[model samples]
Target: MEQWLGSLIKSGKRVVAPVKHDDIVDFAVISSPAQVADDYVQTRLSAKQYVFPKAEVLFSYKKDGKDVTIDDVNTDEFPETVLWKLHPCDVAGLEPLGAIFNWDYKDSLYNARRAKTTLVTFACAASDEYCFCASVGGGPGNTDGSDVQVTMLPDGDALVELISDKGKALLTDDIKGETSSADGIDKEKFIAKVEKKFTVDEIIKKLEGSFSSPIWQEQSDRCLGCGACAYVCPTCACFDIQEDSHLHGGRRVRSWDSCGFSLFTLHTGGYNPRTTQSARWRQRVLHKFSYMPERLHVTGCTGCGRCSRACPVDMNLVEHLTEIASHE
Candidate 1:
């Protein structure tokens, strides 16, 4: 499918995938095969931007008189975009985000983009000290949110496993002939490795018990509250709604916000719910580990370790979970 993907992009079709730039791989629009790099450790940004862009103009507005006309963003002409070689962690993060977006009021912009894009996740073999996807129900070959999953086996043969209709449609009748057993994927070994490092059931219990612990404040003392961690996190989906104006009139804009920001929980009446980095950090953990799971029936963390990787202070999320989970 990689070669086929290259053909589509080269042929001027919209095939957005991961490409290396400035020594870091990021998902971008590609026009050739030479542009892609599958071995990139972790992208500086998450795959969420394809669906929810960093700085998207929700709509444009103009006012001629007391009667103002609002023009809704034209998403009716979106193109078919294919995301290739995404990690399981980045892919799985999209699940919980869907709930919040579709709740109360529907976000047509985000939903429209998602509907047009097909996710093709590439399995990862390399593990880092900060990575704990195994603990979060992810592995080297997890196929959760992936429509098409490409697994590179030790024998130098690639395994193309299709999970959804979009994945099924990508295969030509000729390449469809290569049907090998998935038994060699080693599901048991992948699962066992995660279980040895962490216990999901016990960790959930510990997370439930420590909501008001003083450790939260002590651990977060050095945090700068720059919002970098949450901004880079695929699972962090907090957003801000505002009005972008040009004197005559304005349009309402919704942009990505972070819980790490001091202004995040600030009320319009001038009361700040979470006033410090310690409080903000606590909210981040609770939202991912408790509140989201309670409402969404799934934890918000993918354990991709991007937060740890991108943190200016080098605050490790894996270490945080392990410390609390192992505490007596």
Candidate 2:
């Protein structure tokens, strides 16, 4: 693994992997295997930022008298990036996240970045209470959006599955061992057991008639409207475009936004559509379970449980969704 990573770095491909920083695990650029976190169950943040930046300049404009000059961002300069050691759930999230950007009008900027990024996912050998990937059409071994899937065996060797041409392209002669038949290897035995709490279909169906349910209020009463959930969520693609102006020039920037924010739905006329936390909370759940599934034919969540982990108020998504699914 170290040699392969070193080779990629030497080849000028930017490799971002999970790294442990002061006991917190998050994705960071690494040049060596020693910088990669080996004991982490999940990264504190997703690798989505490699493709979709938190804030990016779309274009710049300069004012000269009555004429304005516009310069658009060049997508050609985007680096070829490799996201390594990502979990299956995190990799699965790329599907819905990609769908959001490419569903209607194609986002050239997003597509360009996404095209240059390759995913290397590691199957989960252990899980915690917050993980619910199985309930959302994902599993510890799910490789929905993985270019390369690596499953570690009990004997310290790994079973590497090249799922795409890009994945196969990453292999070097040293890393490409002789292909062996896995006639009796049961991958399930090596992965974590994540119980299915509620299915996506059931959640979608229940959410269809749950718009005015009191559960939103019940669940959001303690919500601080911090937007931590959306920020940490791998599939949340909501963004706000703003223009930063100076004396002679300005740039259009797109920054991440969240439905959980209190002012997210505020109108220019001082009228807010979602005035309460319950409404904001309801939008967050329904948008993922009901709206995206109905519109894009994809579940917006991979059940990574990052939102729950990042929430200061301790809002457990699986618990809330399971409760909603049980609703009449």
User: Which lDDT values do the candidates have, in the order given?
Assistant: 0.78, 0.89
- Per-candidate TM vs. native? 0.91, 0.97
Question: Which tens-of-lDDT digit does each residue in 264-311 have in candidate 2?
Answer: 888999999899999999999989998999899999898899999999
> Candidate 2: TM-score?
0.97
TM-score of 1: 0.91
Angstrom error of the Cα, residue 175, model 2: value is 2.2
Q: Total clashes, candidate 2?
A: 0
RMSD of 2: 1.3
The C-alpha local distance difference test score for the whole of candidate 1 amounts to 0.78
